[model samples]
Structures are given as structure tokens and as C-alpha cells.
Target: MYTPPAFRIDDRQRLVATIRDAGLATLVTATVEGLMATPLPLLLDETEGPHGTLYGHLARANPQGRLPAIGGEALAMFSGPDAYVTPAFYATKQETGRVVPTWNYVAVHAYGTLELFDDPDRLLNLVRRLTERHEASRPMPWSVADAPEDFIRAQLRGIVGLRLQISRIEGKCKASQNRPAADREGVAAGLAASDRPADREMAALVAAAPP
Candidate 1:
């Protein structure tokens, strides 16, 4: 991910949390036909591997599931809160007018060999878990049992399951940590005052990041 020393995140716990919080990832793989990427939500099993294992599915029509990963590995990229930082948010802007705009963001990259499966039972379980995870916050949560059995089976048949056992993971949090305390504070304050939810989330990360 070309992370500088100050931006590197080696803490597995934090990396896992970031992945979970992002809720979706872009899966990238090498193929004979070239590289293919799919933006999908993946369920992470932190207990499954040295890093973690990811589970998800895509339409049967997506060739990404059928193609062979030339390197026998794939990458899942997760992006967290991010905000644009303007030079006006820096103390240096007033002192020397030397600052430029930059972005404050959090991201994680996971690499692993992918394993595809079509077993109805496992796919059913995967969909159920994925559904529950996303619906837990709802006033009335829905379940796989809410649908007709035959219809659910038919739906599952049209998709293929993906499992990636993570071999390596990397995280980067570019949150204005390289800036001075005053500049960082200014940046955080600017982002926090913004109306966008993403900017507010990024403000918290920037405020909490150690310089």
C-alpha cells in the first residue's frame, strides 16, 4: 500500500476492526484474462487464519469467481472514513501559507488464496449470517426463514460462494499525523464542522491520531 513509516498500522486488532467497520471490500485477483475486481461485502472470520478468513458470494455470472488467480492469491481492500483536508485547515496557512490540500483516510489490504464453493448448506449459512449482521440494527430484523424455502434455494443456486484465507494484511491511517499539533487540531475542527457524515467520522479519527 506504499505506506510511510508514520502511517503504517501493524496492530492486528485495529486492522480487523477497520475491516469489520468498513462492511465491504474490493476483491482483486489476477487471471489469465487479466485482473478482475469485485466490490462486495465479505464476512470476516478472525479466528480462521493467521490473519483472518473472508466469506462472501457473487452472481454466477461474475467470471471473477471462476477465473484462476495466477498467483494463487487475491487481495481484499477495505476503506474506512476519509475527508479532504484543505490548506485553510492548517495553522501554517496563516503563518507561512506553505500548506496544501491533502486527504485524511483509513484503509486496509488483505491478501490470501481464495477458495470457491457452491455447497447449498454453506451458502445458506453464509447468506443467513451476512443478512443478520447487516440487519441487526433494524427495528424488526429479517431472517432467511422469512422467504419460501424453494425460492431461497433457487436464489442461492444463482450465486457462488467465495472464501479467502488471509495470508497477509496491511493497514494505513493517513490522518494528518504528520502535521503539527495545532495544524492537526485545526484540521480536525474543520472536518468536524462539516455536515457530511463521512467527514465527521474522519474528524474523530484525525483528532484521535497521535502526531
Candidate 2:
């Protein structure tokens, strides 16, 4: 994450919020064979460690769980709202024709050591927690207990649990913070009018950015 000072997000609470909101993360590890990455929906336990702890599961067939990670460190990347910022959206471009296209986005990178386990009890609990988190907002929420016990137990056997004890976190929010106030306002307006949900989400972030 090559973040300039203007775009850096160092607030611990904000970083944790971003991670939790992003929901999905790319888990990357440097293995002896090569680098391996898996996209997963992870749960962040902020009280579990200094930075936090990430919990997820990998398919039993996924080799990433079996590989020896380099230095025992892994990186989990979470990407939030993002949108393409066209030059047409920059007021400076019209004034001086000096501005070009850019991207506005938010992201967080968590570094931690890899911990893999297959204990049935722990895996079951992890699945239940993850399920509850995602289903909490639904009108008709579902639960692990809704399924048959033998079936759920068998399903858990096909996955391996992953735990990352986070050591550090890096966050970046490139929401036109480097642009002039007028240009940033233009960007926010442009994004707000766009049809893409991602664009609309970024519009709010751009509007909230410091001038």
C-alpha cells in the first residue's frame, strides 16, 4: 500500500471499521512453491490481538492451507468503495487542462502469522459466527442449527479453519483528498450522479474527505 500522507488512514477504529465493512479479503501467503492467494469472507475479532485477529476457512482441497508460508507471515487485503475518476469530473481540468484521470478507493492491508486448524468444535463455532454476522440484517435469518447435525458435521469436515493474529495494519483512502476543494466537490457531484453503487458509495467518502 503506497499511501501518501494525504491519503493515509491511521485511525485504529476507522481501520477496523473499514475491514469489517469490506467483509471479503484477499489472503496472500508466500509459499516455498510460490505465492498463493485466496479470496475469502473473513471475520475480524478486534479484541483478540493487538491489531486484531482474522478468522475464515479454506476448502480442504485448497493447497494454501498445507503450504509452509515464508517467515510465517501472511497478508490479508480488504478493498472498500472504489470508482473511476474521470478528468471531466475535475474542475481543475477545465481551468488549466492539467488534471488527468485517477482512481478513488479505500483499502486496508493486515499482516499476521498464519495459524491453521481443523478441530471440528472450533470450525463449527467459526461457521456459526460467520453465518450470524452476515444474516443478522436479513428479514429471514438462517442459522447453522437449522441444518441437520450429521450434515453440518460432515460439511465442516471438508473445510480447514484459518486464523491470522494481526501484527500490523495499513489503511489508505484515496478519495480525491489530494485535489483542490473545487475539484473534489466536482468529483463528489459526478460520482453521486453515477449509476454504479460503488461510485455512489465513493461519492459520500469524497464529500467527507478533508479539504
Candidate 3:
């Protein structure tokens, strides 16, 4: 996360919002063999610790979960809207023609200590909460109890739950913050006109950023 001063997102609320909206995140850990990462849809408990805590699970047989981590320190990466910014979209390109292509995006890095578990009860609770969280928007929401008790218990046995007590949180919004105001505006307008959904999302973020 080599973020320039201008592109740094210091707003805690905004960072949390970005992570929540992203829904899924990548969890990275330093292992004896190097780095290991897992893409997961983790639940965030904003009230859990200093910054917050992350909750998720891995398959019981997943070797990644058994590896020793760097004193439990792990990084969860949440990525938001992203768009490719072409030099042609910047107003500066029309003047000095010195602009180059770059990516405008939002991301959050949550550093924490990861605690893994194989407890059936806790894993069941985690799965229930995760299901409810995602299914809340549905007209007919599903529940963990929907399945047979024995089957549900069997399923829980095959997975391991994890809780990450977040210690540090860093957010970055590389949305043309370093560009001239006019250039930023032009990029936003260009992105808004693009067919890509991600571009349109980035356009709104750029427009909302302070000039």
C-alpha cells in the first residue's frame, strides 16, 4: 500500500463503508514458505476491537489455514470501484501532453492478528450470521435451521472459523487526487460516459472527492 499523501484516505467512516460495500476481500498472511492469500467474503465487526475485527472461515482441509503466520499478523484487502484512466481523459493531455495512463481505484488494508478455530458451535454461529447478513436483502431469507440438524452439524465439521482482531486500518483512494482540478473533472466526466459499470462507480467517487 504505497500511497501518496494526496491519494491517502484518512476518513475512518469512509474506509469502513468501502470495505462493507466491497463485500468480498482478500486475506493475506506471511508464512514460512512466503505469502498465502485467500479470497473470502468476510464479516466485519466494527465494534469488536481497536479498528474492528474480521470473521470468516476456511475449509478444514485447506492447508493454508494450518500454516504458521507472522505472529498471527494478517492483512485483509478490500477493493472497491476501479477504472482505467487514459491520458486522453485528462485535461492536461491537451495542454502539455505529458500525461500517462493510470488506474483510479479505492482499497482498504486491514492489518490484524488472526485466530483460527475448529469449534463446531462457533463455526455454526459464524455460518448462520454470514448467511443472514447476505440474505437480509432477499424477500424470503434463508436460515441455518432450514437444513436438517444432523446435516448442518456435519457441514460445520468440515470447516474452520477465524477471527481477525484488526490493529491497523489503511485506506487509499487513488482517484486523480494528484491531478489538476480540471483534469480530475475531465476524468470523472469521461468515466461517467463509459459503458463500464466500474468506471461509472469511480466517476461518482472522483466527483465527490475534494478539489
Q: List TM-scores for all candidates, in order.
A: 0.97, 0.98, 0.96
Sort by TM-score, top down from the best: 2, 1, 3
Residue 7's C-alpha lDDT in candidate 1?
A: 90
Q: Which candidate comes out best when scored by lDDT?
A: 2
- The whole-model C-alpha lDDT of candidate 1 against the native structure comes to 0.93
lDDT of 1 by residue, 86-108 (tens): 99999999999998899888999
127, model 2: CA deviation in Å? 0.5
User: Which residue runs does candidate 2 get wrong by more than 4 Å?
Assistant: none
List pairs with backbone clashes in candidate 2.
Answer: none
RMSD for each of the candidates: 0.9, 0.8, 1.1
Question: lDDT of model 1 at residue 176?
Answer: 94
lDDT of each: 0.93, 0.95, 0.91
Give the per-residue lDDT digits (tens) of candidate 2, residues 1-211: 8999999998998998999899899999999989999999999998898998999999999999899789999999999999999999988988999988999999999999999999999999999999999999999999999999999999999999999999989999999998899999999999999999999999999999996
